[model samples]
Target: MEKTKDKRREKISVATEIDRLEERRARCQDNLERAEFRSRKEKLSEKERQELIDEMAIMNERVQQLDNELKMLRGENRRNMLLSVALLAISALFYYLFYFEEDL
Candidate 1:
């Protein structure tokens, strides 16, 4: 029972973490879009333009990092699900062999 509870908690935490990261990625995308629009719509000093470019680069890097992390988390979640299914199957087989086969 305790192990089940722990597993449930871990699954929930991973899901929530994924949600948080997705929200951050969305916000970063929005910021990048706004920055692009601003760069196109307004004329700015060279230094300011350079700063905007640098900021955009940083945002892009962060987005890439977030993408990688999200991918890893999703893969881990998939593996966990597969492992759970396998374990359940094994348990069922054991129960059947012990309980039902003996009566036959």
Candidate 2:
């Protein structure tokens, strides 16, 4: 009877160890699957990053073009203003010389 009881206890211990090993194996498999999923997610398009860079460069170039256009327009406005002032001055001088001086 004692030998039989010892054998039963040994069998139960071996069974518990097997259960523990199975649980460990399941956990390791889950971890491996999770790692593979993460690796797949990481492997995406660097093209999006490059596209963003290209878009920024194009925007910068457009801004520079607008800035240059603004500067040219401002210079043109100044020249027009100077020409108007000079014409007004010449007209005033001609009026004085032809009419006002004769009346004096």
Candidate 3:
């Protein structure tokens, strides 16, 4: 009688574990189905997605063009600054050569 009771207890424990595992499996499957449904519903049409991608590409190109323009402007500014410095130096040299004689 004790042996029979032990066997019944083991069977009950195994059945409970199986039921728990089955419930978990069902929940996981339910979640997967919900996710798949949401994915299908939330997806954009191909044409609309492509249009958005194209618009982003055009904006990126425009940004690159603006960067190039800014770089050219910076280079031009540097060149102008160097030219001004050179002109100032030449003016000082000429003034010293011609006007220093008068002072002396």
- How does model 1 fare in lDDT? 0.91
Expressed as tens digits, the lDDT of each residue in 1-104 for candidate 1 is 99997787676767787888899999999999989888899998999999999999999999999999899889887898899999999999999999998899
Off by over 4 Å in 1: 1-12
User: TM-score of every model?
Assistant: 0.81, 0.52, 0.52
Per TM-score, the best of the predicted structures is 1
lDDT of 3 by residue, 52-102 (tens): 556555645554554555566556657877998999999999999999988
lDDT digits (tens) for residues 13-92 of candidate 2 = 43354455455545545554554555456654687546544655564555455455556655665787799899999999
Which pairs clash in the backbone of model 1? Answer: none
Model 3 pairs whose backbones collide: none
Q: Cα RMSD (Å) between model 1 and the true structure?
A: 6.2
- Higher TM-score: candidate 1 or 3? 1
Clashes per prediction? 0, 0, 0
TM-score of 3: 0.52
